[model samples]
Target chain A: MEIEKPYLLFLGDAPDALAAKTAQGIVDWRRDWCVGQLRLPGCLADTGLPDLDIATARARGGKTLIVGVANAGGVLPPHWAAPIVAAIAAGMDVAAGLHMKLADNPEIAAAAAKHGRRLFDVRHSTERFATGKGVKRPGKRLLTVGTDCSVGKKYTALALERAMTARGYHADFRATGQTGVFISGRGVSVDAVVADFISGAAEWLTPANDPDHWDVVEGQGSLFHPSFAGVTLGLLHGAQPDAFVVCHEPTRTRMRGVEHRLPTIREVIDLTVQCGRLTNPDIRCVGIAVNTERLSDEEARRVIAETVRAEGLPATDPVRFGVEAIVDKIAEEFGLP
Target chain B: MEIEKPYLLFLGDAPDALAAKTAQGIVDWRRDWCVGQLRLPGCLADTGLPDLDIATARARGGKTLIVGVANAGGVLPPHWAAPIVAAIAAGMDVAAGLHMKLADNPEIAAAAAKHGRRLFDVRHSTERFATGKGVKRPGKRLLTVGTDCSVGKKYTALALERAMTARGYHADFRATGQTGVFISGRGVSVDAVVADFISGAAEWLTPANDPDHWDVVEGQGSLFHPSFAGVTLGLLHGAQPDAFVVCHEPTRTRMRGVEHRLPTIREVIDLTVQCGRLTNPDIRCVGIAVNTERLSDEEARRVIAETVRAEGLPATDPVRFGVEAIVDKIAEEFGLP
Candidate 1:
């Protein structure tokens, strides 16, 4: 039975009046889209008051679950069984909650396990807007790059983005994984939660919704990134980008008396290629984007060029190569342009 | 000052003959002693390996540098100038080649880069042996558990290890990071060339120094595994351990995501805790260990009760209570136990 409207509940620590107002905003927004009425449960009626019955939600079913722990200006206390139980009782297949502290509690964990619910921990609400399966374009072009955490992925991605835009192709940047914003040309943590949400939501949206936008999604962190790896791989598999751009530095050193070996840049590229082939054989490797930190530009260029050529690939200016060049190459290779 | 040992050159795949011979029972075992000699040029060797460059070594001021591609393999062609030039003109540095594939068409990369040097990628002949740090007796005791890879960290650490262990004394299971075998295991890999030499000269002694031992040594994966995170932190920071045992799971799922995430587990734990403390200051935590797929009665009991809890901690079972129990009752209540 197709229920036209899904009910959403907002539980938080905000003052009753303000919290109710914010809850009203959510309800209004959803109502515009013909989603069923959004309501604040009376269990959270008091402003600046703690409700222990949040667990009671579990008894209720078929309702959208949304709980804002920040309304209390802190994490949920250990006694949050009531409201949590309620949510579980409600037959929530998926339950998302704000506040990292929830992960540390055993009772909530047990409740989640008992209910067989997946918890989406949202650190930034903005990112949530973009989470979901994006519309597919069979022959669409895309690129991806990664490195160890704090290894200059954003800088390299942004530089590549600017280069591509300068080359005069329609391009837009989508953060495929975790990313930080640059303020005054310096990286600053904006809102990882929001960014993640947006990325996720964008997945469900079609490129046709916004034509003329060629997307270059940035992946955060190295191969082992908890969320990044799964999300990036999923996007690549689903979106089926025509080509890939790998950013790497070959001069890093390993630790002493330790043997946790990382696959080389070449190895990573090869694995990506293998995965790409398995997913979509038509996708081709365009080139590599190498960050020249210790090496001078001339040295970096020469070494990168040699390495690329050795791998049987055409090398381009890593600093100057952008989205347009990638699109052009993909078009030329695939007979699109 | 040239030594009579005629600087042995171990080239080709599996070049560390001495290490191989040692592992194969060719050499007598010694603790905390180097098994081979590495001679660095007053300046770095020219065109022999990518990591042995004289200029780079000089730049680091004669300290041993652990530089190499994380999983470099195969041969190099003559044309590859950057790495080759860096290797040959060396000062005092150890360069070990593993799975390097630059031997074919090496000249093309070098000539293209306009660097002139006779390059030969040679493997190192040294074998590193494990030396236990010796038993530590801290003011307070902490038990650590770890697996080779993923292997049910949260379950084993909190459920099994902490539950049976936390009694009588003040104890807790706090996650520090993901730990692996290579970073904490014993043994080393011997170069193939060294193995050949030992085979010809010390055939009688080869059984003890097998290459398999070397591979095992280098195979340890993490120092800060999630299962082992609590224990590793205690070990490094002088938290005494009454006893410690690693949980071994034979399944591949336990070891699957380890390669990429193990190295970063330490950082993640630290960040999570610090982030948590910023909002709330009541979290208490202690040591941790691994959860094995199968455990002998003796091993299981020892891990669950004696080894973990013998120190007379406050809690009876930590695994049941989860991280909150450790944080509130242990971390915030005590200093370091």
Candidate 2:
């Protein structure tokens, strides 16, 4: 949201289904700054922003061209390099979360250097993490648990952290993914790490050194995401959180790239608690953090109310209604000042 | 067991307790080819071999001085280098399991070069591991479980692999530690990897691509060993073993270097199963692989008998009784040839 200039999201060759992820995330989460979006031919008109080509978008005062997809394996598709280079030449700063570096390519490097434009490689990390060791450090942790990957986990964590801080609590946001890393200026991208060290990485990020502070640890993939469940388990064990907030996108019908339908909110909350208590027997799911981006504000509130009644857990649409209710609940439960 | 030349174990300034782990392991496991033991002032005398200085040991036909301590953090102690260099100058080869390599130090490198002696850095590995995507691979895995660190996990694994091989089963020993790396000449050191990648290293070592083979995956740290339990869980998950054999040194009164008493054999078996079943629900603890090195033969048999009777698991000392009973049980359970 620190975007000082209007932007164009370049979704090169990303199929129609994935447009709702990174591209639509910008439109839904940070929409005000986006002037337009560029997509391949015949892709769905989901962004709702004006569609513009590279030259037209630049002329329309789109000073930043964002590569709006964190592709699987985080590998940058080589086909997008040409359009990105042209954007740099047109004096637009470029940003991508892919593992491949624009600085490594000579053509893109020279153009960016000539235009004095910056390229932000979001996924490359320079942090070292020690073993978690399951140390009983002071302070309680509030980890955001998710029913699926990218289900407003970071957004909810940041929102809760902000709300807690505003209410005069010593709260810290612990990032666990690329976007979170960019926002926080520091974090380990838990997904990019090797399998065994997932818990250790999570443990390093959310150290419980102060009894009064709440470390709002961001969640990564979910217990149901087939490709990323191990990381979920690792993070759960490593955090050893005293309490958790379960996150879910209510509109989603199935887990990503699989045939199975999504589990009920109650089932997911129970599963999240079970997974967390595997390493931390004292962990409890305190409430639900619902992602209602796809629904109207009125519908979001309805869904939130329904979830709270159905699961008998306090639930909130933090993005819509603010996180104070959930924050106060946590403060009351943990005796946070 | 493959030593063609008489060896001297150099326990340079190592305390008695740790020396018993590595030096006595060499004496007890591969004792036939060793000629003497070397120690500095105030260091313990646990090796029970003839005491010899550098020149005397070399003159007495000790052509290789093995560094007999795998220190915590795998870092080489600085004081050990001088004696190691002196031993190399006296026509002895160098061997060490420390993460810090004597071969990487220019002074030691020059000394070894001038003496035409080889420097063996047992822990510095050049292997890469892929992520262990939870797939039900073809082969049945046989992982060694342990009651504590350095309680003969690798020894049990190697012994079982050897026995199975000798009996004409297609068995492979997949090592996960420094000593096993030296014995095998190749392996990813699972402990040295960052917290997230332990399981991937195990998977890379024991690819279950052939259903007819029995992959004997070497265990690293124990499930209850505080500092390294994450690694044990990762290896177990990565191996996805159908059956496992527990490795225990009956004399271990406490978990290594920790105040907690060792878990009973049955408790450890249950703990091992629970930890492994975190990723693989079907993993079973099939039998017990005992290390009777510290006990008299009669006492060793008594402990083994007690464990077998109490736990209802077949038990054997692969060194004293050979691994036939355990191997035969595995073959029968899996209906293997």
Candidate 3:
């Protein structure tokens, strides 16, 4: 029922969404199950990631081709569908996180069926959710709230989950979006819910019965964003988190889809904290997570150091520098051994 | 086809939800379209609403029995099925706004089907929504926000809508919850949406194409409410209203389902204005709509007088005194004729 071994391919190109998260997840976390990546000639050449043809990929123990890029709008372009069809024809299964499922598209479905290839539409989880009561759930729920939408909230949350588990603290990643679903294979896409039940949807995702466990609810939107701020607040309220990490991409100026510039990290933290108090007054900000992809290693560290100094919280590039500081902060607050 | 004439029944019970909003709506706003009321035993006696048995209701020009009263959990209680069955057997079409649809239950569905009676589930409307891009919508939006959930947002908005039209403004009521939908027959329940798409759902409902038309959005939940505040913020962003009216239930000491006390009228107005500016910086709070249901008419006037004097904006019990003050405020702000 599942592809045990797979050759992940970007095929044509990768969108800037999720910051190439799907590809990186397969490459770094599931590398043992990965055969190698298959890309067009000169495509993804300089990244030092493995680039193989469909034939060579299968020859090196690949059983399927998992298309890894989550492009903008999540639609599989007509041109890219051909390459995916070619992979199915080459006797390998194909998987994608596109919003348009291959199983739903007649052309892709026919090609997939003809080759008897398995398809994985990892964009959304089919979990039937109950209404969220926003009861006091046990086990230190922590969420990664961001300064803007898509500013590494998921990335840092996942990294912190890994770091926490690495330090022997039991933690889990609750996926909020498709990229998170592709990586974790779980979580309700909160934004897709009907407005009346958003809080209930949040309650359903992280129920109120455990004291010794931690639920890392994935955050969505930004409090400052004119368009997506509601989702941001909903996730904040839904999680009812005990502690949180403020995720920020330092290079951005204006908020997405709006004319206003981004709020200061302190302002975002203050807004988040103020909003969090609406549900739980004791909620705390554990750390600051800065996305440093645009900066050099030295610059990233300097920016993080400055953020830590200003915010009076431990700060880090969760992906580049690891989430140990933030994880440790959570562990200390929750009295994890 | 809509039923030309119908009796809207609260059925077995009228829960506090919507403050029996479904029944009150028919009696208050849609009186011309309503035939009479049907209740089980001693319910709804003092309201002077017409209480009719299924047979008598039919004789009195009732063609359908609408199951009113959005019950606590929106579930139809077991005992009410008998009365509903009697209505169906009487050749009366039944309509309900419960989350539990009549068509979903075998007993109710079969009874209605066998009797050739129609069923109307008016609580939910299915609209394919697009992601809110946070773009500037063209028309001016005026939302009625509240200090607590169910204080009087919909009622105030509806009254303002009437007053605006009476004054020759191109105004419309955009309902955001079930009661609003029952009254207006349109609007997406913003709370039922997935977390990420709440803003989008709002955007899809009010597309950005008109400048002269004004949308009086019926708001849900207070920004401080623990149970459903996210929907409040989402509606704010989705509507991106240029002006707002703060609705307050002055007698509310504590917020719903929480230990937190309600904020002051000034605080509520400030918070609504601050959050509204997240999407539209020029957003303004035109006036206050006081829900003086707990106060006597004279007492209500005194409270309104006190509020208007203190807040320096016109304040009124919209249902009793009408929304002329708030409507005039909106009219002045937008330079409406």
Candidate 4:
């Protein structure tokens, strides 16, 4: 689903900053794409954009109202309907990352229909995708894989996109999750698609491009995470990445939300190459992205150094350190100038 | 979705038996659950059941009309709608494995609503499932893993279920595909569910049971298959089978609908165990099931014997021979008497 640009992020009655993490993510990465923030009275969360009403945001060239907050049950609160309908009435499209669709609200649906405005439900895929063909497609691709869920896969990819583009390489960040979709403005929420179409959706998201161009594709759940490894494998196959960066959280003892222990980075690389060879024969690990937020500066450096020595690849905390080293490794490995 | 018993198989103007293979599968597996066949004019397919009109089938105590034939383009022909409506009017729920939902047809929806009848769209899941938790549940489970798609996974599981039951062990065949669902009378079409819930749906299908009772789960796709490995992986994590059988087709040249070549039986066993260990660390291969339809009787026996020697597991053609050897292996391995 392709959402319009210059969004007015709707932070509806969010109780804390964590509740509006999606909005915060957009603000963190693509602050220029956001026109303003629209929050209800009880909302305690903030994206720190200029607060504006629907009319003001629309006048400022906001083409979409992004409902980027998570309600307690992922539901659309009854009171938030008015502002969403008002945005639609004002000729702006609406997009949401909620479990519930925006069009499910009667007021929002009617307003969109009357105004000929679109409602993008990013969590629900409206695209009908054919099954993945697994045929080799043109273009270079790099995917970010994780040791576990929420282990900086998206951040690593987005950072790579920025770094590679700055270094005169043609690159685009391809998204596979809701926040990533809103940031990229066009992507399929791969997990939300039917089980049969996981890889198919990923294939569609990263179609054949120029031979030298790179699709820095965002990844999802770890291959060892039982809850979501299917999504991770499908994305891995569909992306057919020539190079991948393994994202890891060193402090985590167990996989997120499960009893299974996190797999070692070596294990992740071995299995990824084994399975990824189906679509791309030359799939290889290029670097490591460590999420060392919980570690001190000395510990982070020690971990990164140890990872580099052990894996024999560039390693860095994408948030704490820039992705320039990894970009340099990609250039050297792929013979890019 | 749980379909009612005594189905009236609807073969709507199918030009050949291949088009009505699903109906034929139900007939072959569960003849007692079906009342009779309902064929439209010009139908060339037959399950060798008594021909019956809608009224006659309903009179014979058919509770559901199974639209078990695939029409051209997976669309319901306009001509067949009248009979479907008539069947609903006669107090029978309708279940179909078509790509298009039954309720999408206005006439069928109206008829079902008017008669308080239900519509079962097997290709479209209406069941909400949580993400798989990967927690071990109590039961003895055996899953069929395939070297490729359409390699007799379902048949192997069903055969094992029958054999184990006749040997005085409590066993149930858990369906994961369309035809298996019809034959078993209940199961979520795991591939049709949202990608995030593939394992979750499988867990629900084979829930906690008696320690010795076996849930013989039907498998889909293969770990080596490019288009469907995600579903296969999710099923592996979710089913957490204590023992598995590798199903192979002896004469296949490549993986189904893809350019990649098939993996060896050893590769399938190794990978299924490697990935399946996330949920069930005790996962092991008990046997091998080969589809020997294209082979001569002597060739089939030779291939089976070779497979037994190579893999050190019980091997047989479930269709040509029987699953008795596999059942014996399972009984011995699990101390099931």
Candidate 5:
């Protein structure tokens, strides 16, 4: 599902900044793709994009209206339909990150049909994927795995793409979640796919590419996470990365949304390689990306230093320090430019 | 999804016995639950049950008409609809093992609504499931883990259930696939559920039972299978079996539908234990269940003996030899009467 570029983000009466997290992610990663933001009255969220009406967004060459804000229940309030319908009527395609489909709303569906515009429900996949073949496809892919959920896997992957590109390596961030999907403009939300096709959908997302070209694939739930390990394992098999970075959160005691204690970074690496070798025998952990948001700078550095010493791999917080060390490790390991 | 008992098996113009495999499976496991078979003209399959028309089958206390045959493309032919509708009109609920929903056919939908009957598409899950919590629940569970797809996992679980029950244990066979659902008369086809809910569906299928009762959970794809390890892992976590049997095929060299070597029985046991330990800390392998259909009697005995020596556990072809050894191992290990 290739979404049209230069999107006009719709933040329809979202209550807070977290509600506009998807839009914020798009702005953070691909700010150039966003033309502006369109907010409904009483909307408290903002991505700091220019405020623009439908006609102004169209005039400014916006091709798609992205419903990036998520309200309670991921529902599209009845009052929010007016702006979406207006955008479609103005000949702009619409994409949404909602629990319900935009096409399920009659006004939005009809307006898109009448104006020859497309409606993409990014939360739900309409794409049919074949079961994963486990074939060794051409391409040097690097995936970010985590010890638990809500780690820095996605951020580390996006960072790797940027840093690897600067080091004269061809790289792209392949997304597997809703926010990453908008940032990359196309990707299957693996969690939303039918259970049997989890690996197949991941295979489709990052296919055969140039041998030296790197697909910095975003990861999902950790292999240790009982709630979502299936999605993580499927992504690992389908991506079949030659190199992977283990992402971790240093402060969390238990896994998110469950009673399970967090697995050590070493355990994550061992299990990933054990399972990942089925598809890519040469798979290895290149580095570690730790989320140190709760730690002070000194503690973050100390923890990262201990992790690096313990695992014998480069480790850093991607947000505070760039992933240059990880990129260097990749280059040395994979013989990349 | 409690399907009413006393099924009327519908072999609708099936060209061969292989096409009616689902019906044959149900008859093999639950002969008493089947009233009789109903076949259309030119049908080539028979389950050895007495033939009866829809009215006669209903009169004989058939509560459900199981469309338990697979045609090319899994589509319901137009001619097959008449009998299904007739059965519904005769006041029987209809359940199908087809790819498309029974209600998708307008004629069948109308007939069911008019008669106040229900339609079940066993291959598709309409049930809502919560995410799998890694919490240990009350039950003695045994799961069948395979080295590859179609390696007698379901058959092994069913065999264990029957043998254990006859030995004075309260054991139930929990279904995870389409045919097993038909045989058990209720289950969510786990593969058809959304990717995030694979484990959740498994948990629901084998909820907390009496401490001494066993839920003999049927497993799906292999943990070594690159194409489907995700499903296997999720099932392992969700089932949280206290004991598991490793199912293998003696003659298969490669994993099904993929170009990969089959994992050894040792590999399957180790991986199942490593992953299964997350939900059930005491998880361990009790035996090896081999499919010896391709072997002679002497060869089957030799293979089973070799497996028993190598794995140091009970091993047998459940179909040819019986699961008594495995049940004995379980009873001894758990101190069951």
Candidate 6:
């Protein structure tokens, strides 16, 4: 079967010069190959795209894909997802460099499924590839920590990263969400798809020096934050990090009330593992990070560790507990040691 | 205008038997005084009532009000705000027992305008009333401390309350939003509406006392938290707290990106004051409560005091400066001394 060219769709405030340059680059790069590339030029309509140009693009090749580069800031609007999905179903690889997740839009997900094209969230992808180091082999074991927005996941991850570096391990902090550069430090740059590719490439990367100098990539947000979640899932699928670290905090009242009913950490962890399995089936048992405020450090660690362990998984204290100890436990559990 | 029965809207899951019984008691008591009180039957949508058998009941005409009582566990869909506003505008004085605030839903402000009724979030109305008793005296001064959720607002308020009580004046902790029940052995509740009514009733209830009792209310969540912000605003409007103790950390990163965008403490203070004016026009300058997390006691106090005074307002360290110092400064400002 002669593969059709990739279809790219651009959304958001009018494309900037950089985006145009990137698009032209991709088109030119594909010109030398047998791959055909086309761009869809129109805003998504309320009833979905009914334009004839889109149809022509689909007819030219069964590989109709929509690539959208939007700077709308947050998540892609649900309405925009429908047209992209339609374009994808017409046989195209749909790629969006939206700083947000499109998975939040069911229509987009459904459309992606119909088109057999994966929905790649660009935020995590951009973060993974921020330093443009591309994918490199790990010199040691790598672990990534992630959480939902406002959940104190980054602080926990940073604390872990600091802990690992203190142990004389060559550690690097890789941020995977809408996290700007200053927060995550300079590291490799990989888009969502590319991060997954790099994760697969990790198997062939450089061998670990101390077997612990591996990297610690921080997942940006929860499985619910549009872009962050998808990238986390993709990385988990591709890289199969030694262990997943979950950070969570109880809502204010501590008492789960009617409207403010809080989801238990166990439920959240279970859901996380389940979601990760969709992308990668080899996720090991989860570890939990509890933001300690109001509770004393000792008490917070003990309580969270006990709760997580009771949920039938190994849990470690992200605060008082050293990262080396945590990694060791995870290594033992995953047979990495 | 012929007066009509008043109603109360209860939003929540099925009210507990105790709550339902308490509600019925209020209705029965009001009935004896010819104040016809009715509860929204079953769900909120059941707006129709069995033809008011008014022939058998004596007329107690004041206003026709709608009261809704809902279980705390029920999900009050966002759309419910529209009907709630409509019920309030249709000359129905809607009084809800559960906590409701504009901060909880930014859309509430717009929806309230659509129905020509302003949203009066009373999440802490009950708690405010319970604590106002301690400060209920003619010419008695009241003060409040607030912050976004989890910023140590409760501790600041409690500490201030203790400081006032230790000074031979009646001082109590008033609940504004997230705070509830026995703190430092004082009965604290987070009810703003009830506090306002209690404040009004206290003046008439106790004429012999100096009315120098101070009520300290604690606010929850950041300025953006939907429930806490509205509760803070409502309490300020109703109680007209004599002064505000702004609890904050000394670190620059504490402001997140707000410091760069909003830029100076004066701008932040002015923005707070402007928002407060939406609920009350009489708020005086605010003081500062520095969280002593990473700072030494003296350093924290000095920085907080300097920051507060820099805004041209009185500032005191809750840890080093003591509540007495704060009260003394505020009293002097109000010419109480």
DockQ of each: 0.01, 0.13, 0.38, 0.85, 0.86, 0.01
TM-scores of all candidate predictions against the true structure: 0.30, 0.66, 0.75, 0.98, 0.99, 0.31
Model 1 residue runs over 4 Å out of place are A1-123, A126-135, A138-141, A150-152, A176-212, A224-232, A255-259, A277-281, A320-328, A334-337, B1-337
Q: 1 or 5: which has the higher TM-score?
A: 5
Write model 6 residue lDDT over A126-201, tens digit each, in one string: 3221101112233433444433445555455566666656655566555543231223322222222232133332
Order the candidate numbers by TM-score, best to worst. 5, 4, 3, 2, 6, 1
Identify the leading candidate in terms of DockQ.
5
For A1-337, candidate 2 gives per-residue lDDT tens digits of: 2223577887776666464366665566457778888776556545778878889988888887877765567666677778888888888988666767767777778889899987766554445555556656687788988887768888888888878888888888887776565445457777665444566777777776778888888987666543455566678778878888889999999776544456677766776665455456678777888888899989998999998898777898887777777877787787768
What candidate 2 gets wrong by more than 4 Å, as runs, is A1-130, A146-148, A166-168, A190-203, A222-234, A248-281, A289-312, A315-332, B1-129, B193-197, B222-227, B248-281, B290-306, B316-322
- Native-referenced DockQ of model 1: 0.01
Our model 4 lands, by Cα RMSD against the true structure, at: 1.2
Candidate 5 A-chain TM-score: 0.99
Q: Give candidate 3's error at residue B275 in angstroms.
A: 1.3
Q: How close is candidate 6 to the true structure, as a TM-score?
A: 0.31
lDDT tens digits, residue span A1-337, model 3: 2334655556466434343556666565556666666665434432236777777877786776676765567787677777777777878877676778878877778988887877876554354555445556666688888888878888788887777778776778877765565456445667766555566667776776457677887888888876777767777887888898989999999877666688888888888888887666779999988989999999998999998888889999887888888877877777874
Task: Report the lDDT of model 6 for residue A32.
Answer: 29
lDDT, candidate 5, A114-157, per-residue tens: 88999989879999998999999998899999999889888899
Better candidate number, 3 or 4, judged by lDDT: 4
Native contact fraction, candidates in order:
0.00, 0.08, 0.61, 0.77, 0.80, 0.00
i-RMS values of the candidates, in order?
20.4, 4.9, 2.7, 0.7, 0.6, 21.0
Comparison by DockQ, 2 against 5, better one: 5
Q: TM-score of predicted model 4?
A: 0.98
Query: By TM-score, is 3 or 4 better?
Result: 4
lDDT per residue, candidate 1, A138-163, as tens digits? 43445564533344444444554555
lDDT-based ranking: 4, 5, 3, 2, 6, 1
**Fraction of the native A-B contacts that model 6 recovers:** 0.00
Query: What tens-digit string does per-residue lDDT give for candidate 6 at B31-93?
Result: 332233243334333223322322212233323232234345423456556545544455343
For candidate 1, give the lDDT of residue A317.
42
Q: Is candidate 2 or candidate 3 better by DockQ?
A: 3
Instruction: List chain B TM-scores, each candidate.
Output: 0.26, 0.72, 0.82, 0.99, 0.99, 0.46
